[model samples]
Target: MIPSTTASAAALELASAYQSPSLQSHSHRVFIWAAAYAREHDIAYDAELLFVAAMLHDIGLVPEFDNHTLSFEEAAGHIARVFATGAGWPAARRDRLAEVIVRHMWPEVDATTDPEGHLISRAAALDIAGKNPDDFTPAFRAEVLAKHPRLNLVEEFLTCFKSQATRKPTSSAARAINSNLDSRMLTNPLDAN
Candidate 1:
């Protein structure tokens, strides 16, 4: 079984490797929201594991492959293998997070069997439904409310949106991604004469 510590590190590594600053920030926000939701609802889950899984759930975003027809089981299994091998995570914990990630994409599947799995799945759904970067109108609010009734996600998102004005992206991270891009461009400058 993959160690929990290893799983945590793998999640952190995935977050660090994300290319888009906006996407990374969104990932961070989703994790925070998930954690908050868990506490708010008095849901019993391994908060650390759930948070890690939620944060890194979309690591596949880097490749941007079309897996529309892929079953959640397959996608989750692939993610588990990827984390285990790519991040040196152990098999057991990777499998756990894999279950969470896979089931998250398809909520119709049974979710109550595992606490962490349920939380992560719900958190990801809430995140996707509330992805209005600019506006969250009444229709959007109603949609999220109806779609993710467990967490009262729409209400929480309202709270989150109001508070977002106080938050800003980390400048250091922005600089790091930019520096990495600059180095890559220097090495393979398409416009170089």
Candidate 2:
């Protein structure tokens, strides 16, 4: 159900070029999960925006895009903004895409205010932290996993976050680390099941 657009194609290309295999799969899963949730809830969202944002949400975690000073999310936002501009998006739409990427790291995003942001946040939370495995049925989850395997995502993500936190103590990665994100990742039922 990906929105096929020039912007989305560019996003996918960039993701494949920059992200590791596991990270690339994670990006795809994020998009699929967000789209599924929005569809199930009858939420109206900008599919193209959400798709592009999902493809690049964690881009900054990659060494090529990682910023020494900015948090990974923020760095990714900046990257998406430039990418959107190159794709000929207007300023407001570009900013919205960037905002959605940045907001995915927030604890919560109001659906009324930004449906794409809310969907991405919730979807990423479910995929990464196993916050709501029941949101999707076991059969659906199995199908998704079969299409886009998890690979070495958990260990890889844990390592990335730990490094990010160590380098940027005030980043959201640091906050996640403070909240025992590692334990959550390790003990997530999604992986165990």
Model 1 lDDT at residue 31: 57
What's the CA RMSD of model 1 in angstroms? 16.0
Per-candidate RMSD, Å: 16.0, 0.7
Worst 10 residues of 1 by lDDT: 184-193
Separately for all candidates shown, the number of backbone clashes (residues 3 or more apart, or on different chains) is 5, 0
Write one digit per residue (lDDT tens) for candidate 2, span 1-193: 8788999999999999999999999999999999999989989999999999999999999999889999999999999999999999999999999999999999999999999999999999988999888989998998998899889999999999999999999999999999999888888767765
lDDT of each: 0.48, 0.94
Q: Report how far residue 101 has shifted in candidate 2, in Å.
A: 0.4
- Candidate 2 lDDT at 150 equals 87
Best by lDDT: 2
